[model samples]
Target: MSPRFEPITGRYLNLTLLGRPHRLYIEEAGQGIPLLCLHTAGSDGRQYRGLLNDKRITDNYRVIVFDMPWHGKSSPPEGYQNEEYKLTSRGYIQMILEIAGALELDKPVVMGCSIGGRIVLYLAHQHAKRFRAIIGLESAAHVAPYYDVEWLHRPDVHGGEVSAGVVSGLIAPTAPDNHRWETLWHYLQSGPGIFKGDLHFYKVDGDIRGKIDEIDGRASNLYLLTGEYDYSCTSEGTLDIAKRTGAEAQIMKGLGHFPMSEDPQKFISYLLPVLEKIRGAA
Candidate 1:
């Protein structure tokens, strides 16, 4: 049967976090258990547009995606551009906590990709009891050198175009042309230096290799799924984390760094089983 499209609502909320007030853009659909989805670095919540429109998942989950401050429709707090906006582990967790509290989400299943994926490790370690489960897509225990941050922000280079070109190389060669382009489109629109700032967190502050043992999978279901073609956060790296933390891990075939957007159908194929497991556990 063809899947029906569900109605999605977009709204904005002004909340104070990290000692500052910022506007956050949120898109939500369906009605059931909450699923808070976080987007890849430099990109916005638009990555989950397909899931928000899918009735099958939406029928069983209230899916919500939000743009981080300074990304997408969310406006940055005062003095954001003047001072470099680097993402910190503490600040990232605080943002999620604030958003969830404001939305009154009851132990939502938190999912994220790329840097979004990296942040979930912190969430699981720091606030496991607050979430029903945490799914880290293309997450790794340690993210070594893959893409150069300097090249991404060089004044001589066209930041957006160059960023898209670099990201395109990381996507799976098997991904559809349309899907690949659609995924690249987000990078092309991202603000300058935003990607680099996010990488600071992904490659540096987000490292949890030594602390993976601190996470209790029994209390907060931790799952790691990496794309077959993701060179940055390889499946081997993710599997290592899973082994260390006792969290479930899987490799998505024919997928890449941006699985949810690169090929939603293929992504869902892998995600469905994970969701079912979470539901059963709940």
Candidate 2:
């Protein structure tokens, strides 16, 4: 009997960024226009396994996903133990552009979820010409926190389980058990306080209410899709952003905060039309 092997290939790149040396893990499948996938906060590139394997999307796009430094197969920086790992908008933007440069991609289309979603807006506003297009899933400029993040990093708390528990409610009640648990599994494996650290950027540092007007949506070809069930990044907020920034927007039904991971099939159904529009424009 022949063993099964996925078309996906995983590799590591040695990158030194923000003045520190680090190793990054990346995966790719299919080929054509490069389509980069960014995972949600507290998770890793593994969240995109479904997208990489889906031929409908990959047949026309080179699907790429990477574990940010300190996430998934990517190890923390050389001296990570001594430092606090809070992510800042300045650092997040630099890391993304640097990764794109390192890969030598020719203006890849960027699609991001959650924190990944937030950065896509920044990319649009600051470097619209660098990408073919930007897609934000469960994205918004600013969302006031309903809970204290300190709970994700308490000395007595089991950070991983607690993080997963908090976000479990954010997934749609109808998400399949397999995908829902898989999404939470990523959070369950997160480094101590990494979830809390990433939120520092999402809830505080990366606020773009003032700067969103600067984005030329026509040039960036911005698309914003927020799940109807997502309390974290509400559909109302996304619609508001679409109105303010001239971005094409929609509210995904029967989905939640982690759309791509929680319900890839349904999410892809909606995503296919958007991809068609992007491809036609390209």
Candidate 3:
């Protein structure tokens, strides 16, 4: 069977950055403070479809979601030197800065999942004034664990095997079927090259746990959101990040890594108050 497309649409933004016509698939809607939404490494930014389209969040903020180069419908750059640029967090961050400037958004709030979560944390650490607030769902303090060679050297997989791997050892297998199956399926086949590059990027140039204090001092707001059952980022790990950085942290009860996809209504409930706090600060 063919893969399912997310039931969301906004704009197909194309802009020349670094002398290339990068295809940027963005979901921009509502009218308020700019909120840029990013997805995990293996999946396209469309992972944010549910949240970006929801009335509760969008009604209060001008939410924007976009796929990075080589993921989803966003075609990669021409003459792309995969080895030189693939999978580096720096390159992704550069694209993000350029994308934000192109959208005419100024220091918007950033929200991400998994790797997306990591990216926002990196930005908050390195470039705090660029964003109004930072929200990470199942975010991490470090990168080496997930991007190890053992996790990437595996052979290509079909949906069943991918689903099994995602539910095993990390998220609760008893989670909702459609949410579980779809989220796994989408990430499994997006692009192995891009995924592999991402792993390489983190392994070589990733370490933020030691610098949490530096990140906290610069950002206006930092929030950590994760599911109680999210073994991918253990409760201990998230708590350690929160404690060191002195940021408000939340662990959603009975949920797992994919809390936004698993239970968006509950996800939004946790998200709104934090966003309100940021807005009030502004």
For each candidate in the order shown, give its overall lDDT on alpha carbons: 0.88, 0.92, 0.71
**Backbone clash pairs in model 1 (N, Cα, C under 3 Å; residues 3+ apart or in different chains), count:** 0
TM-score of 3: 0.85
Candidate 2, residues 86-204: lDDT per residue as tens digits? 89999999999999998999989999999999999999988889999999999888978889899999889999999999999999999999999999999999999899999999999
lDDT of 3 by residue, 1-282 (tens): 987854355677889865678877787766699998877655676556667768777777888888887778877777665443456567667778899999999779888777776777788788778888888887776755552344443566443344336444455455667766666766666665555555555445655676777678334488888888887666777777787777678887867777776656666778888888888888
Order the candidate numbers by lDDT, best to worst: 2, 1, 3
Candidate 3 has an lDDT of 0.71
What is the per-residue lDDT of model 1 for residues 109-201, given as tens digits with 9 covering 90 to 100? 999998888889989999988999999999987788765688988789988898898788778998889988988999999898888888888
Best by lDDT: 2
Task: Assess candidate 2 and give its TM-score to the true structure.
Answer: 0.98
RMSD of each: 2.5, 0.9, 4.1
How far is 177's C-alpha from truth in model 3 (Å)?
1.5
Lowest lDDT 10-mer window, candidate 3? Answer: 159-168
Give TM per candidate.
Answer: 0.95, 0.98, 0.85
Candidate 1 Cα deviation (angstroms), residue 45: 0.7
